[model samples]
Each structure stands twice: as structure tokens, then as C-alpha cells.
Target: MKLQKGWKLLSSAALAVVLALTGCSQTAAPTQPGTEATTGQTPQDDGGQADMTAMLRLNLKTEPPSLDPPKGFDTTSNEVLNATMEGLARLDKDHKPQPAMAEKWTVSEDGKTYTFTLRDSKWSNGDPVTAQDFEFAFKRILDPNNAFPSAFLAYYIAGAEEYNTGKGNADAVLVKAFDDKTLEVKLNAPAGFFTHILTQPTFFPVNKKVVESNSKWAENASSIVTNGPFKMEDWVHDQSIKIVKNDGYWDKDSVKLAGINWFMVNDENTQYQMYKTGQLDKVSSVPNDMKKQLIDSGEAKVDSDASIYYYRMNTKMPPFNNVNIRKAFALAIDRQSLIDNVVQGKQTRALAHVPYGFPEPAGGDFREKGGDYLKDNDIEQAKELLKKGMEEEGWTTLPLVTMTYNTSDGHKAIAQVLQEMYKKNLGIEIKLESKEWKVFLSDQRARNLQFSRSTIPADYGDPINYLELYVTDHPGNRINYSNKEYDALVEKIRNTADETERFKLMHDAEKIFMDDMPLVPIYFATKIFMDQPNVNGIVRHPVGTTDYKWAEVRKK
Candidate 1:
């Protein structure tokens, strides 16, 4: 998934109006402690009982591949990075951009330039945070040599994509620090959602001194220097990670919790056991069979996530190189059955690349206007398409294909269903393979997989975010799918300021994309979990993962 949060407001002027009218009621949440926790800060024995209120214990779905924000693209690493890093702006409960290191910022009338005024803040090591740090970070993200997976997010800035793609020079990219306290940015075009882009961890500044001295600075707890509300205290690789409140934070006085302990447990059943045994305060994944039971017992929680799970076919590879072949696989799957039998929750069946929920600007929803492009299961039609595609290739029998996915119980189940579906419907046999999340991503990027499962949550609440992924050279376009018409439409949306017109172009583009069927859209995701009632103040974003910066463990 493109694991970063994004917001879609009309424009910079409208954003200011909304913020001023809303009265900042979303001020930081006050941290509080529960009477006891499953695990947390080292207990100073009060006779025999350990005081748990001062600590929070949560389970991570997977061990983080890397703590370096730019390189970390999975939800597991993103969740950890969000708590331990501070960016120019942070998202409040409402997904609106809130002040963080940058006390306030303003955009020019032309909407091409942004000026940010910094507040007094320091790193965990007590060194003053400066505007220069941000300048360095933003430029580094656009540096081709860095090979940042999320470099596309910063492309809105002037010359960023050009610089990152080696078409322009670093100095030509218009991000600069005018002084110790002021940072200025010039964009190639007007960007209404740019502020929310800064809330992503990829935009967070790193301590220049610390990162320069140690190549693996972020990988070790002792060497990391962050400016967020919490700082890493210890890390037991693949076992647990411990964090303590940062005393040097600008708003330290407002923070209440002493520490948070995150345990690494990939199995949902194990996490459920830990929560039931009172060794964890929050569990992210609940066992599929136990989902209903946990919710009935008032232990499980569910929230609609702005995400989609899909299967990507390497359009550059044989057999799949034919568009008809792609359409056959996409049309063969019974998405409703997949959701009902495999992915039970509030997950919506995805018939289009962009999920439902984003506004259409004038009225209604963007999805309401576009409607469904992909159809439900049609086995006969799928068979005809596959047969036609095979005939075009002048082959009676094709090589066996393999579908790949990350290691997980739910993923395994979905793969099996698809494997059977294709065999029964199209008379084709495809094998299944699973790898750890990190390995799977690397293999997918290299286009080593013939067919594979891929997912993307909106980095921001816009149709363009999802639509842009299919552009000819987009970093996330791992399937090697490309179309001139699709690329033109994406560019049109980015440059057009009128929402209604942009929506029409996007809707048209989506139709063209579905017609080609480079990827098979499955079901949209709904985050389901179980947690103690005391886990409070976790700000949920519309995109990516939730924010734990203001989290508290208040006694219920």
C-alpha cells in the first residue's frame, strides 16, 4: 500500500476559511493513564502490583522492515514512524492539517508558492530543529540516488519529479530555507492538497548530524533522534519495541503517557490470545472466525478504511500481454463471494479502482457519478475472452503461471479462492506463492511475479491519487502497464482547478483503465480490531494508518 495520509480540500484559501470557522476544537488530546495495562513502563513495585496506567501496550501486525520514513512503505512501519517522527504539519482527528513544527504557513495569491514560519522546537537529542532540516529532507526525497519509494508524493513541488527522474538539477527544484526559521516552497502548479501531503512521514525532517554519522541511524533505538511526542527507548528485533515520552518535545507538557510498548506478532490468533490474556491493551487484527464473537463480547472494533485489495498482472509479460487476457481474469472472479467467504467484515466489493467515499465537489460522491465499470462474475464471457486471447498468441498451451502474495492467513485464503476460480472458469491452472511482506514488495517492484496481489490505500482523498498509479512511469506502476490516453487524463486532472471538470476526466479515465483491466479489483478494506476501552485519543485518518501521537490510556 502507498502508506501515507492525504486530505482533499478545495484550495488553500478554502482551507484557511474552514480552519478559522471550525475554531481549532481539535487541539491535541490530553494523555491519560489506565489503572493497569498488560505491559508498559518498568514497574516500580508498589508492594506487589505493577502500576499499568502509565503505560500502553499494543501489537504490531508485522515487524517493521525499516524505520527510515522514506524507505518504509508498509502500514506496519508507517504506524511506528508516525509516533516517533514529527513533520511540518500533522493531521488532527478530522484529517485537517494541524500545526506541528511549522506554527503557520501561507500561500501566495497565485497558489504557486508557500511560506512556512517555524516554531521553537528541538530534536530528542536537544539540538534545535531548523528550517534547513526540512529543506534538506524535501530535497533528499527528490534526489534520484536516494531511490525513495514515495518520491512521487513530493512531485507537486516545482521540478521535484523532473529532479528525481534525472531530467533536472537539484537546485532547480524550488524548495529552500531562507533563514533559520523560515522555509519557502515553489510549486510547478497550484496544489490545493499540498499541506496535507506534508503530514506524511516522508516529509519529516531528520537530524542531519545524526543521520550523517550513522548509515543505519533509524534502525537502532539508541541512535535515532526524533522530534515527535515519543522517542525510541529500546527495540528487541522481531519481538518488541519500547518508546518513552520525549521530554524535549515542544509540547511535552501536554503529553500525559509515560511510555508505549509495541509487540511484534504476525499471527492474528496470537495477538487475540495476548489481548485476552491481558498482556496487550490493543490488537489490530482479530482472528477471522472469532471476529463476530469478539465484537459481540464488546472487544472488537471496526472502521472503514480508504483502501483496496487487488491483483496485478504483469502487462509486459506473455499471455498477460494481451488486453483480452487481462479482462478475462478480472471478469472471472466473484468478488461478492470473495468478500463473503474470505474477507468478512464491512469490506465493500470494489468494482472500480478508486474506492467509494470521496466527495464529488458539487454534490453527491465521486463514485456515484462514475458508477461501476467492472462487472460481477461472468464465467462464459471470461472463457471466450481467454480463448480469443490465446488464439491471438498462436499457442494451444501456455506456460503455467504463478500468483504471488505476502504471508498472511487472509492473503492465503484469497489466493486459494482465485486459483480455483480461474481454473474452473477459464480452464487455466495458476499456482500460488507467498513471501514475507518485505520480500514480496521487492519482488513485485522487480516485476519478477507473473501475477500477484497488490493493494493501495489512498495517500490522499482524491481520485487522482489512485488514477495516477497507472501512469507510464509511476513508481507504483509495478505491473508495467502503460497507456497514452490514461497518462493524458491524469495530467488534465492535476492541472485543472475546477472540481466538476476534473471529476468527469477522472471518471472517463477510470473507464479506459477498467477496459484495459491491467489489474483485478477485489474488495475494499475495513480495519477490524479488538482493543481495551482504555485505549483513547487515537486520531484516525481517512488515508493510510491512524495517528497515535495523542493517544492515551485513560481508565474506563
Candidate 2:
């Protein structure tokens, strides 16, 4: 009760709180997501004398899980996909959706239907891009056989969830390509952020003809067909991927650099050395040990990132099945100190999962308006909760516990810090385990892991993007959390139509989730990295991935 007074609203077997807000239609122009970055440095005027042959070199911390847009849910893959693929709409530097493949579009007066008019764009293979590509892409993402984790992004389309969950036929999904250049999509209801959500790579149109002919079209450069500013020239598996400017692109004249050579180097120290030696123009991460010094010396840049680093406990398993235990674990960590002393990124201490940089549906900052849902490092409360949970489980001795995280220097350090905090606060010693990224994600989806490190970067601007995954058995809901009330609140938020009322429902849902404490949120992310002096025009969207579409390099 330190922040907002969140009281339980229940009376045996009925609804506790009556939502007073009336439903009103969502405004046609919704508030856009925030896109504040360490940017104001404009590109230098080279008077058409900029180097056109050089590739702007950069590093990725790890190899992407897959280059296929449907399977590419992680940052590593989507960062590359965002550069190579063209969606009907793309978020510009302002973080507002703008026309890309689609030259123009219209929303029905009721706002439930969308019609896109495509431009004459050519794929990297010189094939003309058609509306069919989009129709195929949308259905492909929602296809259960594909098992794409981001498939929920398509649930906005009418009948999509039914088809995705194997209950309805593909033909029932209401998205169709009327002709070569026109496509139509009908949603279950009006979502003002529909276009904003469409800006994601999951919505990027793939060449239907190419994909039908080759299953591994995105795996290698030779088989790839992209319609964006760049085309893959070579891919060396876990080593590197090189992309060159696509001359066949619809707006090829706007592209500046000849290409981008993305090197995969997971070790931050090695990447830092490479950047120092001029082998890399930009680094994906800063060594945790050296971050404070780098930030203090003005050598590193901090940009706002809409990501939340948290811990997920399997709600169906063991001692954590107790709500009090989950809340105890959550309150044990000192998030401010973790960010200030250990992480050393200018990240915001997350009191809620929605994070900053997102606008509430009606207007105003969501995090600020939501108030603090989770308590900050209340050691006394944590101890009380732990004792209560242990007694409630009828055990003087606790079950064996473990915390799992994927392999990374920073991750290992964070786990160690958290382990010590838990021991100090609740007198619990949890074992720590590290696994390779693929194995880690596999274990998480299988529900084989007990307690694990988890993070979520908002896929779109809406707060529901952060809240909806927990809906009963949603693909992204790996924690096995299910509550009838919370699910109903989210369902209402999705279809409510009234922006302010919807936001209230979202906030109410989050309050219930935090009170249940299935997961522990640590801090919201801010990207801290170093860049070469000559690099320019890189647009890093807070809601999406880094874009090099308008990037250029000045001859030094």
C-alpha cells in the first residue's frame, strides 16, 4: 500500500468491482508511441560525396534464432528482418506508422476493415511484389502448424485466433488479396493501433511464390527475396550476415549506404576490442564491468528501449505455486541499486511491466498513470510473505529451487546478484543454471524450467501487447498463469472500444497480475552502446528494432 491502495475486490463467486466507464468508440487518430533516443545529431551534408561503396559495420550479441520472419521473435532476428523486409506500413523515425509497400490505405467508417493499395515494388529477385504476399504472410503467422510465437499479433483479425488454435479453417480468416495491388483485412473490432501493430516484421509480406518453392528461402542469401532497402548478399551461419543495398527496391533512390556487414559477437569485451580496433563501427552491447566508465566518459550512448527485464516462475510447479512465495521473491531484489551499480545502464527502475515510452490509450504516460503496482525491495514484507508461504505449504524444509538464465556475461552477473539478495532477504538459496539460448527457450516453452530469467520488449505501442500474453494458454504465456478475472479484464480491454475506459481496464488487469505475482519485474531497458563518429541516419524505434534504411557513412 506504499503507492496506490490496491485492495482485493471479491465476494465469494461474483464480480467485485463494477467498471463505471461507458464504452465509446476509439478515436481514429490514437496517441503514438514515444520514440525518444540519444539522437539529435543530424547527418552531415556530404553534398553527394559520401562513401557509397563501404558497408557500415555493426555487431550482434548472438546469432539470430531464425531469419524467417514468422519464426523471428527475438531481437537478433527481428533487427535483421526489419532491415530486409517491407511491411504494408512501417514505423518511421517518429514511431508513427507510415506507408511502405502500401502506397495508400483506408479504414472503414466503423474502423473494423482496412484496405491497402500497394505500390509497384520489386523483390530483391526482381519479381513484382503483390497483395497476395501479404495475404499469405498474415495467414502463415496465424497458422498453428508453423508455431510462430508472435502469432498472437494476428489475433486482431477476425477468426484468426480460431484458425490459429486449430478450431477454424484457414479460409475463415478474413484477410484477402482482392487483386495484384489491393488487399483487404477485417478485424473482430476496431483497433486504432492496428496499423502500428502492422509495422512489426510479423506483418512483413514475404514473396508467396518464392516461399512456396523453397522452404529454406530465408536461411541463405542465395534463396532470399526481400523488398526492403537491403538484400542479403551472404550469411555465414553463427558468424556473420552481409546485406547490400537492394537496387530493385521500390524506393531505391532513397537508400544511402552500399550495405551493412553485421558481425555476431556475443562477448561484449571482444566486441568492445573490435570497436576500438576499428573492426566494428557499432557494438550491440557494452561490457557490464566497463559501462559506468564509458557512460561517464561520454564514449557510450544511451537510447530508450521499450523492454522489461524480469524473472518468470512456473506458476503450476512446486513452492512457487504459492502466490505469497512469488511475491516474496519479487520484493527481495533491490532494482534501483541493480541498475545503478551493477547494470550501469540509464534504465528506469520498473515498478510496473508496461514501462515508459508508451502512451495510455486515451493519452498521457501509462507507467506514470498506472502508479507503482509492485513494491520496491520491501525486505520486511518479503520475509513475512516467505514465512507465511512456507507454513501454508506445511513444510519446515522447502523444495529444491533453481533459477535459469540463458548464457551471457551480464545474465550470469545478474543471477548471482539476485541469488545473494534472495538469501539475504528471505534466507533462501536457489541454485543457478545457464543454458544456450535455443535450449533455454525450448525449456521455457516446455515448462521444464522452474524459475527463470525472462524479458519482454513491447511488440507494439499498446499496453495490451504487454498484458495480453497471459490470457489463458496464449503462446507467449510461458508461466502457466491463469486467472478468470484477469483474462476477462484483458478481453474487455481488447474489445472495449473506448480509449480511456480500455486503459482503465488494462491498469486494473495489471494490478491483479502484480498482486498474484507470477513474475518479478526488475527494470525497463535502455540501450547503451558505442558508435563510430561517422555513422548517421540510424533510426532506432523504441517500440521496434534498429533501422538502417536511411543510414549513411561519411568518408573519413
Model 1 lDDT tens row, 329-435: 88887766555434656466677788765777787667666777766676677888888998999879966788999988778767876776777667788989999
Candidate 1, poorest ten consecutive residues by summed lDDT: 26-35
Candidate whose lDDT is highest:
2
TM-score of each: 0.88, 0.91
Off by over 4 Å in 2: 1-49
Q: In model 2, state the lDDT of residue 525.
A: 83
Name the TM-score of candidate 1.
0.88
Candidate 1: how large is its RMSD? 11.4
